[model samples]
Target: MNAHPQPAEDGANAEHATPSGPPPARLLRLPEVINRVGLRRSAIYQRMSEGRFPKSRSLGPKCTVWVEEEIDAWIRGIADRGG
Candidate 1:
């Protein structure tokens, strides 16, 4: 068997891999957060202004990203409240 298993037809692992549970930390870009949360750019900014969303951390002059854990927590909160 190959040392590195290939992804299945759907491009996902055929079997369960890691059993450690969710990642301890993750970094995600603005576009990724937007897509995952189904939020518009303007809405994201609006939420930031209202302190309802995770703030981006500066990476450089023109780069920033949100903490994946924060975003995940926010999603979980929303789900818990049935929102």
Candidate 2:
């Protein structure tokens, strides 16, 4: 009997493994953004109110998301400003 687990026969495991290059760009939900930026929802709203953070766009009747590129740009701006 094999002691080690075998990979999926169809390469599913390999396909799902994390890539080495840059992450794929895609809109993230508010909670995900909050976790990534280490800020509470209230603080996010505060920054949006002050025009310091990118605003979210409606994705559905009750859904919203932030543009991946915009968030990346904002992060770059902060890094450039030494924040």
Candidate 3:
């Protein structure tokens, strides 16, 4: 049972790859954001509303994602600020 995660079928997570190959990258989804920042959904949104956390990209009415570099920088800043 090779149960590897199937490639994103047709939604926002679908591979943006051309007929050539996989897309250059993937936008980080909410679960990934929570894992990386160690923040709950509400906290993340609150901080975002207060301009404390990096805002996410709105892919569509139901799709929101973050840029990996932005999240990494925010984490770096947290460490630099002695958090």
Candidate 4:
């Protein structure tokens, strides 16, 4: 056996690597969303109710998360609108 095994050659581990394209979508929990958007829990929910925020997906009965890209787009929208 080689004392020091060499790293795999290029493409040898391609199957284990993520495919090239857009990165995986990230899910942000309520607290993280709050921190990112500077909105309180109530305000976040309020905006969601009014269709002014990105809708969250329920992971379970009591867990919810927002798509990071959607939230980022919302923020960018606000900036673009000069808010």
Q: Name the best candidate (by TM-score).
A: 4
Steric collisions counted per model: 0, 0, 0, 0
TM-score of each: 0.70, 0.65, 0.68, 0.78
**Tens digits of lDDT, candidate 1, 18-46:** 54576577889889999989999999989
The collision pairs in model 4 are: none
- Give the candidate number with the greatest lDDT: 4
Lowest summed lDDT window (length 10), candidate 4:
5-14
Query: CA lDDT, every prediction?
Result: 0.87, 0.85, 0.86, 0.90
- Count backbone clashes in candidate 2: 0
User: Mind giving the per-residue lDDT tens digits that candidate 3 earns over 1-79?
Assistant: 8554455655433345346564455589999999999999999999999999999999999999998888989999999
What global local distance difference test value does model 3 have?
Answer: 0.86
Show where candidate 1 strays beyond 4 Å: 1-24
lDDT of 2 by residue, 1-83 (tens): 96655666765565466667987779999989888777899998899999999998997999999988888788889889998
Off by over 4 Å in 2: 1-25
lDDT of 3 at 57: 94
- Order the candidates by lDDT, highest first: 4, 1, 3, 2
Which residue pairs clash in candidate 3? none
